[model samples]
Target: MKRFFRLPALGLAFTLLFSTAAQALTPDQCRDLLQQYYIDDIPQTVLDQETIQQMLEALGDPYTQYFTPEEYKLFTSSMEDTVLVGVGGTFSLTEGGLLTERVFEGSAADKGGLQVGDIVTHADGKPLSGLTLDEAGQLLRGEEGSSITLTYLREGKKHTAKLTRTAFLVPTVYSQLVDGHIGYLDCDTYGVDTLTHFVDDMTAFSGLATSWIVDLRDNPGGDYYASMGTVGCFAGEDALSYLLDNQGKYSAYRTAVESRTMYPALVLTNENSASAAELFASSIRDTGTGILLGERTYGKGVAQSVLDQTTLPDYFPDGDAIKITSYRFYSPGGATNDTVGVIPHLLLDDDLADEAALLLSTPAPAGDTTGYLRVDLEWRWYIDLDQALSPEYQEAFVALLEALPDQVKVWQGTGGADGWTQTSAAALAEAHGLTDYTRRGFTDSADSPYRASIDLLATYGILQGTGDGTFQPETPLTRAQLCALLAQALNCKMPSGESQFTDVDMNAWYGPAVNALASMGLVNGVGGGRFDPDAPVSHEQFVTIMGRLAQRLSMVMDLAWQNRPDTAGDSFVGWSDWAAEEAWLLAEGQTGLLGNSINLLWDLPQDIDPDAVTTREEAAALTCTLLQWVGILPELS
Candidate 1:
């Protein structure tokens, strides 16, 4: 959600001269608000209120309250601004079948080979059969430059198209009278002309609704004046809130006496509701004017002010002035709500009845973790990376490098390390101190194609043959087995951390590796907070893991490499982008250590077999490959 101050330049307090006769704040209110109430310290009696306001603005607070002259103009201009960008296609998914109504010329759709009248069966790979057009549109829409895949049906065969979303205009406010007697205001954000549109809506629903519901879910705050104007519509001339400063001083802000509502009202909110929306809901409830429904409001008690550009040299001489949290706001009842948010009168649990019952019941204390995970567990993994890579691998890698320079830097140094000369498998094994070793179970297989790779793995303590002299080469590798092998190949230590997945027992053989991999951000559980450790590892999942391993090694080795640039971050780059690069490496005939390493894992297929369940032999070969790329083995001849 985009949060910004919405008031115009004319409303700026700083624009009015410090000694101007026409002022909104009284002498005491001005002195207290500027000198005593602000987060910073100020002189008792030295300069004018305008200069005092500028000094108060210098203090960094959550609410950047004071806007400089130039900044005030920009703040007001945003309210009247229009023009946005979005994905470049028109869609309609009715019972008649999902139809592409139109595809904009020269847009992402046209560039990606999408044509008008193409029947889209699925959006982002999910079937569009049961979804409303709006839902499907929402699925297709995303931030500019972010892509979504559409599994579209053209003629009789199925084809896929990926498109990057661009900007497009979308309304911020939606209001109507629902069920004949209920005025329903579905506000997406508080923007310029929002209050005007809202007032028009209210007048239209004046003789209609007996009750009202102002829905503020997913609202990223906008103009404070717009929100305050909204509050005035319900709270009347009452003291809406008090702003408190560091010096124990308070300033009262009253609502417009003429705009109060007399009807019973309910404000709908959710976890996404924040900033000005929180203030609006809390003020309504505090003034005994309305009841709050849904979850607790997002706790964003601090406000920001837009400072003028002229004051930039005074405090921060580099850029234009900004909003800071000068004062902490209090409810009309005198309760400070900063980190702690306004509690709802009714708790919504996806239904009104369930919410009513839950709200009435004694609330359980909140836990450290959000019980629900946000991943869609049911997504199909049939879309091949090679399909996207085969045609646009170069462009994809360039994009990947741009988006994730640090990860790419690690990958770029794969065979570029010093003292990392190409060596034979036997020589690489000897270099790693693997001397006293003998084949136990596979002694009879002298001509086995993978004997060298298998022996090298065993020598390095990366794998052990099956018991009773039987190396079960044909057995499928389970999730747990892969975790163990990868951990050993990476030379990672057994983790002391507890398991986060419900199915991963702490005492299990793979627990340490699983936990360690997760802690290192190399793996994530299959949703529902459960790690299906025993499930057979699929070809796609293994490659995904291998890609992560390579990137992790890249980052580690890059750090130790002399004069390497600092590019580390909190999270690893996404696997899809890196995996696409890996696909390119396989598609194009790249050789030496990197090529030999990839070949050891899987024979390069035209379209990588993402669905095929990999065998134990394959896992072992891949582990050997991992060792080779990290400079633990020589390039394959």
Candidate 2:
């Protein structure tokens, strides 16, 4: 059932101190805690382990770790607002030494003239070239008031500086007005004070900055409350994420603070961005408040709960504790970011992402040139319609550009590059009057092999884009999302009232679709009154759904099994036993529902792996093929 938790004042406060000499919890106690709180089902083999460490190892969850009193103290300190006695800069390990990534203003690193990009090769006369990032950091940090000498390289020249280490609060939020028009907020971590700092910066840039860029690259996430509040500054007060526990209970985690005046935002992320950092990016992107740029984020969607004496007094009389994975969280759109990280709207090199955002935010220059159309699909796409080309092509392009809805602005631009628009192949075809346009403007699907199928489905209003102007064809299609698409394709009447599944909220965008499919007996819940809606649908499962859909539509399959192609029987061999019959019916020539020969669903060299997850493009192709066979959509020329 849907439940709500009172947002805690301190989202993950680990402040209770423990004695250095404390006894460790027994294996049985550890197993019991895990059994009660862990998000996933624990195996009997894990419970059979003899020691606490062995049990945790067998559990195979890296995030769930048992810590002694001393280790726990250190862990808690790291999670809290950090106070470090070290050189005031974040460094990334490189072949030569540590490459300075960020230099805090008015700090020892800044005062020592250690600019970003400078390599710190030595610390206190000790060479740091072969050390790990943590080892290098340890060498640089010292007790407060201690002096250290750092040798660094700048522009291929060696330099030296002597600086004293002092305890300073690690800055979580860094803000500045970029190019006097873009408000740049760089969050190193989402600590307790991050939200307040972000608000102060937003208030400062209220009138001056027209656009904003949030940089979360290399940010190992911090406090959950702080992250949610920070995202609210852009996306407004809303349920930013949904958390599911082991007991089949779901909780909506909403933003705590009021939103600020919103503007066009570009959120930058990288592989190092994890946990709460991912939450911020996903919330912003899913809410349509901004576009994500840079590499895919580090996927860490599960939240850990700290178990100690205060929470479980009977089991833990000693100071030692265990941090156990308690809940698995999903994005605002009901997609889990656990193993699948958030994909950016535009993937660009880390160093070039900021520059690209700046260019995107800047307005095009005034009328110096004409006969050029600028298409704004998240990014700028300048197309020179007047370039030296055939008149028929130009006429078709002009007609296509003109046919676009008022929402997608196509205006005059200064001609630079020749015909460089981000318009998808499907959009161009539909615009040229070849197909009835349904406004499925997905710029990212131009090069997809399934472009034809995607275009057909989109033209018929059976497929949809990811709201942010691109079709993430490679992204895995979730069960709930697939259900929504199927409901649209079949034109199922929307079911009213509450959803049958406990995890599926009726108010959610996919709720009615799921309920409609469930009411039709075409879909089923995972178990325990839950749908597991966010889980990716496997290939065999997707085909099985299609078979069920075909049956529900009362479509006839008169072709006999003996009349099927010679390769069809072999093709069905690899499919799961449960889905084998349905899979064979949909293969190639059996039901005339799938492609044959050259465009076979399970063609050679790319033979079907039944357990593999179905991608959005694959789903589109299969759905489009079915719709065409059923006369819902026109067959491909």
TM-score for every candidate vs. truth? 0.37, 0.56
Q: In candidate 1, which residue ranges exceed 4 Å CA deviation?
A: 1-82, 85-169, 310-319, 350-637
Predicted candidate 2, C-alpha RMSD: 15.9
| 1-637 per-residue lDDT for model 1 (tens digits) | 1111122222453354232232232334344444533465655433243443544434423353433344544554444433344556666665534777445445677678876568888777688878776666667767788988888777767889878776543345556555476676766667777777667777788877666678787565666667777777766655456665565456777766345356645677766677778777776665666666665556666555444335334443434344545666655554433433554543332123222221112111123211111111111011122221234332322222121111011100112222122223233224334343222235433455666566555543456565465557678998887888766555455767568999998799889989877876778899999989999987767776775555434322222222322332112233244344443332222235544423434565444465778887777776666555443332221
lDDT of 2 by residue, 260-292 (tens): 765867888887788889888878776777777
Please report the candidate that would top lDDT against the real structure: 2
Whose TM-score is greatest here?
2
Supply candidate 2's per-residue lDDT for 179: 66
Instruction: Note the residue pairs that clash in candidate 2.
Output: none
Residue 235 Cα positional deviation in candidate 2, in Å, after optimal superposition: 0.9
Off by over 4 Å in 2: 1-23, 90-101, 109-165, 363-375, 378-412, 415-449, 452-542, 545-637
